[model samples]
Target: MYAAARSMSRRVAAAIAVFVVYLSLAPPVFPFGAVVVHRAAAQELDDEGEFSYRRDAGNGPARWGVIRREWSACAYGHLQSPIGLSDTVAGLADRPGRLGRTYRPAAASLVNRGHDIMVRFNTDAGGVLVDGVAYRLRQMHWHAPSEHAINGRRYDLELHMLHQSADGNKYAVVAQLYRIGRRRDRTISRIEEYIERIAKRKDHEELIDEVVDPRRPVRGSTIYYKYTGSFTTPPCTEGVTWLVAQKVRRVRRRQVRLLRNAVHDGARRNARPLQEANGRGIGFYYTSPAHGMVATGG
Candidate 1:
């Protein structure tokens, strides 16, 4: 009896050792943290959900509404993201109410979000001023094949720089669209270079050097499309103020490829289909003389 008891003890010890090894070898799964701010706010965004791009098993955008009780807006909301920018909409001048940006270079980190690659910027990197309210820069992410269309045209890429107001209740997005061309836009190239460095990582993230400037893409553009929309991801929270740059830039095909390689299940193409306007009027903000005198009202 004593010999049998000792043998069982040895077996239990071996099993415990194996379990510890397994735990150590497991890959870490990180929830999109800190940048999301309030715990309830993050939960409202479904920050911990396994939001996927696959459409085969009801995992795509169309099915998001039924996936969770809070995500009903994904299917039910009228105001949604990636809407088409129309020229017929009345133009608004970037005059007395022009957007004011004081963004500067700061330490940033890149994360492989499984759904997309998100880069979070330091809040100290002064954000944009919209309608006299200051919205600090939070993070930026990319969508392939352009989410928002320009005059019914979809470009090769789209970058959404998200910002939050002082109260954190209000949100604004600054979108920059890109097309494939020969011009090597320095800002985009540098960002793509960093993305390439972390492309192979899955559910992993790496902090990049402070060489990237968050203001580079918006440096030259004064024309933009402003309107109200919802978050493209789950919960599809509406009332988001969107400002899409009318001045499109060029990006190398290879750079777009880096974005493609970084995502999972060959779901690199992360853009949502253009949503219905639902009687929403669009406003154009431009200083270009070619667009005639920019009017104030929609």
Candidate 2:
């Protein structure tokens, strides 16, 4: 009886060991009905220039159209772009004749919608005063090496002041070009002081609160160039209204260098190469009247 019992015990132990080994080698099981894969069309540059629709996989080249089924794969194919005032000026009609001289006082309700920690300021026609046509301040951000190339020259920095209608349908962006010059802007000085602090911490969310100043007067002439273009980021959705100031603002060379150094991915350049005009029209708000110029598609 003792010998039989020992043999049975050995068989049970052996079966348990075999079960353990099988469990260890088995592939993991995921939850039922979970998606294991996704599909989408992707965009790729035609490096070799092989001209065939089926030959290219994912989102085909600009010439060929391929629809993506998965979001992850399709994300690359979506039209997204960097923010710029220059690209916004396409397809605007020219206003012929001299522009009427109108002066208005700045309103006190100039709210800074820059990423939380709201800042407020007052403005006027010539300088900063409170009480005029109320154009709600939307969001503010930066561009590097400037977008608007005047006579084929790009500036060092550009600031975008986005504004929208009360209803949120109409949109306009005010762009101020910054060139490296001897004169330093007082407003930039204030903003930069906080930017330096945020740089040390490397906390983007925390830094947004530190950077806005409503008291700093809005400078630069209203003369602008207007156009229509898509956002410069992914899903490059087009049809945004754009207003680019004709005048360029001045910033110290050291300031530009500081910004370049402080920002992550320390490369100073961030501007995108100009895209094809795609049959868009460019309009200019001249002192006399607005004018439109057809852009030859690049």
Report the lDDT of model 2 for residue 288: 35
TM-score per candidate, chains pooled: 0.76, 0.53
lDDT of 2 by residue, 191-255 (tens): 66555554423334333333344324234454556566654422344555555666787889877
What is the TM-score of candidate 2? 0.53
Question: How many clashing residue pairs, candidate 2?
Answer: 34
| C-alpha-based local distance difference test score of model 2 | 0.47
